[model samples]
Target: MSQKGGKFTKEYEGKKTGRFTRNNEDRKNTRFTRSNEDRRSERFTKNNEDRKSERFTKNNEDRKSERFIKGHEGNEVNETRPVREDIVEGRNAVIETLKSDRTIEQIFVAKGNMEGSINKILGMAKDKGIVIKEVDRKKLDFLSETGAHQGVVAMITPFKYSSVEDILGLASEREEAPFIIILDELEDPHNLGSIIRTAELCGVHGVIIPKRRNVGVTSTVYKSSAGAVEHMKIAKVTNINIIIDKLKEQGVWVYGADIDGEEYCYNTNFGGPCALVIGSEGKGMSKLTKEKCDKLVKIPMVGKINSLNASVAGGIMMYEVLKSRIDKKMQ
Candidate 1:
């Protein structure tokens, strides 16, 4: 097009006519996008390295921890497994244990059941400064696996087992001598509780059992002992036979309770320091256990059962031992 003052004219409008027209803004946008992409790429690389470092740290820590635990397996470190439900129920059977063991956490009493004879138990608790809580029936039901709690349950740490060597040291310190019960897998906690109670009553030193096969203290055992397990010195060993051998070394006469043995408990001399071995209910003493006993004697059965509950058998034997000691003292 021709204008009045122009010989030739090319009409160029705004700075936007295709790629070069928007070049400045587009370059700005491109630079912005490139900056953002660069930031994102840097962020991704940083995150990847962080994750890798975290995994490496965790793996090495796990391996080191495994090695530390593995190295300590043979060493004597205090270890515990969860106490069995029956054992929890029976904790009350050993009342003295409630006082002696620092690990007794708490006692649960049924809402209205903490009265009367149970009141004395509360009194003991009060004296010992134990914490008591009144829980709902539902809570108690959930806690006590053995339905026989009869309104009382104790939360106890695993029974603190002292060593046979520790008891031997106790025996060695005392001029009066040691009186111990060497149980050959007495399976019932009730019997154990009662015997422990009796041992405490009769002034026996401590009771021993094999680590495996024997009944650990249970809620029932604790209940049956009427709190006796708490007071009696008890040792749990890896091997019952090893304990027997140790007892014999320490001058403790080994006596096994059996029907076919030569002498009756009444006739046998309990004049010296002694270890009484009682067997399980169905299988009395294992053959190996029986073979280790210096003497195998039976408690005479007047009743037709021909066998006694381990606790009863043990109680009888404990009293006999006590009586023998008394008789010897009199002489």
Candidate 2:
């Protein structure tokens, strides 16, 4: 009975040891599964953070690019605005202004350009007590309207217009017949400037232009005139037709320059107190204005083009009148 009891006790002890080993193995498997799940959660969180960082970086780059483009456009706008019409640029223009009776506010010359005609300009400015400033080339470029400043720019007072009486009075003061150049809706500033220069040389008493439809004397005109605008007397009237009739009553012969004129300009009589009418660049004289003239005179042209430039045609007519007057004087 003692030997049987010992065997049973040993078997029971072996069974208890096996149960303990099984419980420890189950615990190890559960711990390993939990560690794997924790590692996966950590990796998922790290990936989400990295994606968010990438998106934020891209958004910041887009915003910076947008600001840069807007700033570039704004700079272009500031560069092109505010064109100045009161400034006269170019060396010849400034020299003529100095010789004229027109008041100059100031003169700006580009630095390192004091040679040749520049010295002459400085001497004249000193004589007139005009302010002379030496500025950077870029400043002169900014102030220039004609883009041909030639390193000099003059800021002068606005042009003062003359009246019809002033023009007639000038002729009277010179003890000569009235030699006038009347512009009919002349649109080109360069044309007007060239006409003024020629008229001044031709000893024209004054130039008559309508207040409307005609270009006012601007900087371009001043530049184109090469400063002849200073010597020429320009009268802006409301109605050129009315002035024509009044001149006729005063015994001034009005002549229209046209392609279909009755007589050639050279044959026509311009010896008396005369006013020549020049039309616009494209269209010739208006019908009513043409009718008001005492006679229509044409320039001889054999070219394929039917019309001449307004300034060129006007110059020829003016020279004819000047020649006629000279011939009469010689006689």
Candidate 3:
């Protein structure tokens, strides 16, 4: 193109052209896109932080629940102490328990079912003065683990049997003349417990019971003994006669309680180290057990009831023996 002066001159423009303009535009576009990318990155970072915070909070809550549940095993959720349930049910089970020297916590019987074996149980319970509660059959059913509770259930303490040596050691530790009571094949835990309680009160040294064919200490016996089991030394032996022989060798005179005795209980000398043997509930004394006794004494009964309850008779005999010892000590 020609200039204003009609002279042949090169035309030049001051405005920027092609490549540089395009470069400037590209730079601006890159800046804008970078700004957008930065904003998106901030948003994504914020979102990730929020998710992490949520996960942390959830994890804390789960940990707390785990701790709470872990703290209570086989125990109440709110209870501070752990507790265990020991439930024994059934007629013969309960009966045999009562017969054995066991610590019974409580007895539950079905209401309105007090005949037959249940009656026998009640009689045994009464003789031992065990705590009995008559409840609905459903209660027994709920308490029954075996599902064969013949209208009765007993809550007993865990049994802890002692050796004969333990009893002798207790006597030796006391430094007093050993005054022991022996139960031969006595079945009722209540009777045994009652005897133990009375013996404790009377300051007896220890009590010996046969392990077989006899009630070893049970919860019912412990309860019936009125917690005297804690104070008294009880020894369980395989054979009652062997223990008797051992006692005799230790210079302890053994006396047997029988219906046919050579002398009355009052007349029998209960001085020095002596052991009194009480028989089972139904049978008085076994032939072998009777032979083990150094002497036989009887409790004079004037009542029409030919046989006395084992516990009652044993209690009477225990008092007599204790009284005889006291009288001799005084003299």
Candidate 4:
């Protein structure tokens, strides 16, 4: 490891046990220990322990240096993107949002309104893993879009609804049967949002809702979906019956949710190209829309309540269909 010069290279000197480093000015004329070959060989055996110590120290420092320098310099050049905000105001709106599967950025509660609705909103936000911020009434007023803060407000990302074609295309691309959810004039944002969230979790391709006589995608639905609306593909159409006809032509069998239907939800075979039509919160499916259904399915209830929450009913039917498909796949 010796260099072909007057002075020995740093590499050779490093191998020596205790050689003092020479200054640059004196390096050209530095002297070495006598009998260099014999001294080097003698020191080699004794230097084993020191060599291990030096190697460990050098390797550790190199690894530490590599962490911040190697394979990470390119990442440092990229800028961090900012998140978009969708503000939902009012106590009820904020509460319903926290209950949905939506990702809430933060909740601003007006000071001194934490008694009833505001208190419930705060609890729901905390339960849903949302960030809550306490602010003055003026702050709530400033963040409010509807001008009716009702002592609570929330900031969330906007909902993105998809197209019916995209939903069917997704099912086609996956080479699996299309499992779709169609809402027939649903009037409640909470129910729509909850149904969207449930559909997303249950592996449905997409959801379809009529553009009119339905509670359109709103902040309340976004929140009620607990944020699952973001991952779901929801399409708005002018007429759900037309869409049903189209889906049927594409080999999708339509199942309508009714209080008095021919097939019980649990007993029905929901294993192929299928669409489940959920009716409005107040009125079930419209007469024409119900007539468009290939088969009518009902939730069997022994309890006193004849009907369930629209979201709950949709969720039950969705899972039933999902279970049937999954069991078919297993077979």
Candidate 5:
């Protein structure tokens, strides 16, 4: 009986050991499977990160390329755009420019709108060997700065400025006393233009304006001058007071137009070599400039309004000077 019990115990012990070994093996296999899944998840995460990195790099490159293209296009547009001051519009202005010595780059006429004076412009342009182009009215409208193009626009060289010596030389060549107009910071382009037209008609030698605080020879001035700008010599000076002193030394009587003047404009003697100084529209003249004048003269006023438009007063004063010269010539 004792030997049979021993065999039973050894068999039971061996079976228990085998079952425990199998359970240990199952745990190992489960751990290995979980490790393998962890490795796969890590690889998937790395691949996703790489894809995200690639997308981010591509997006950056696309943005850079887009900016480059837009910048290139903007440069092209800027290069093709015309300068505003280089353009001259309107029929009379263009025709007068054509008749002048100014260099016309090209003349653009509105298509199917060439009729009365346009034919004359074509003839004049042909005579001068200028290039004429027919374009849509929209093109002219776009190029017109004065909004009164009248179907004709001329692209000309920038208005050339003359020196003070050149202006005096022109008077010498004409064998006339130096009849000059010196503006004191005139702001209005229309007023400047009208004054220039009147100056041309009155046989004035040249017009002088300061480099600062004055309207330049713009398209509006050109249109207002009725092409008279072409025939006029305009000088831009650094110091108008210095120029006034120099003119006084040269025996040129410097007259200032002011509301409060000792003498009327018609009574003033403008017969000699003279420079008529027209003040600004708002302020009559700078204190320093007024002090520099040889004489301050006023236009006669009987109307309720004591003040006159700068251009109107300037015109009246200019006519008075011209009348003085004519009267002197007759005497």
Candidate 6:
């Protein structure tokens, strides 16, 4: 491309002539000359291959110096953000977290106490694509969010969980029907806790919960589930109704647990591409969410109370679904 120029009132119709603006025009022409993609191509693909590589490496050395090798040779420096507030306390929680997807800034595995749990933690960290730094127990304590860094603490990027599509695709790869549980705005930390434990126990494929107005994994929630969170793929979605619709489109039945429903959970065939939707604490399933449900089933309360505790209700539903799958398998 030819140099771009300014308009002038003089001859040649397109000739640019000016005093101070000449410098500006010259500057624009220089920028265009430098901006040509052909120059970059030439630099990258020189007649001399070795020279091309050397030039490329030289130009990119600034980005290179800052990289920490988490096994890959030239992987991008893991663009980590601030440490999340969740990991500063429990030793086991820190170890389990290190096994997951969150990127680590630096790990402070306590100075001593380096045998059973500590060694395993180090091994897992190496396997799971993170850098580690051994430091004094005080350092771990200082970084502790709960002052319980347990001689092992890690500063990590915000936790990144799997997407609904990824989890569903994973389940579909297996031969049997994929069972998924959708939690609709469940608030109690303990409720979130037990649901994950029960879901994993029942071999339901994965768990999907809303990103907003829902319970998320915390220490209390994790403890309540008794370490089931590690085994489950928990996905957060912005629109539970839309996700339900999508699941239905994919031939997955969306069943909501409701008191005034046409069917009971167990009587319905759970041995299919199915997802059971459990409702929130106070109001139950949102009306819009309930409408998106393919079918609403109830868990028949035999007692004086109209409703079961949220976690208890979810566990019952999950077990019923699992029982149906097992029965189908036996047949």
Tens-digit per-residue lDDT, 1-331, candidate 1: 3573243222343323444657877998899999999999989989989999999999989987665444332222112223464335533452555556546677887798766656776887788777888877656655554456666677777667777777777767776678888888777666776787788898788888888988777665666767776666678789999878877997889999998888999998897989888888888999998999999999887877788888788889989998998998899
TM-score of each: 0.67, 0.75, 0.54, 0.58, 0.74, 0.61
Off by over 4 Å in 3: 1-157
Please list the residue runs of candidate 4 whose C-alpha ends up more than 4 Å from where it truly belongs after superposition: 1-138, 141-160
lDDT per prediction? Answer: 0.74, 0.87, 0.75, 0.77, 0.87, 0.73
Worst 10 residues of 4 by lDDT: 75-84
Error of 2 at 23 (Å): 37
RMSD of 2: 11.0
For candidate 4, what is the lDDT? 0.77
Q: Model 2 — which ten-residue stretch has the worst lDDT?
A: 70-79
Clashing pairs in 4: 97-223, 100-224, 100-225, 100-226, 101-225, 101-226, 101-227, 102-226, 102-227
Span of 10 residues, lowest total lDDT, candidate 1 = 72-81
Question: Residue by residue across 205-251, what tens digits does model 6's lDDT show?
Answer: 88998989886765545455655776788888999888988888889
Flag regions of model 2 displaced more than 4 Å: 1-85
Query: Residue 73 lDDT in model 1?
Result: 28
Model 6 local distance difference test score? 0.73
Over 1-331, each residue of candidate 5 has an lDDT whose tens digit, in order, gives 7777888888888888888788778888788888888899899999999999999999988987675444333434323444256777888888888888899999999899768999999999998899999998767766665667899999999999999899999989989999999999998888998999999999999999999999889877898889889999999999999999999888899999999988998788888999999999999789999999999999888989888888898899889989988999999
Model 3 C-alpha lDDT per residue in residues 138-246, reported as the tens digit of each score: 6765554334567888888765657767777777887777888888888876688788878988888778887678866554454466557656777777788877888
Give all candidate RMSDs, comma-separated: 12.5, 11.0, 18.5, 21.9, 10.0, 19.5
Residue 31 displacement (Å), model 4: 99
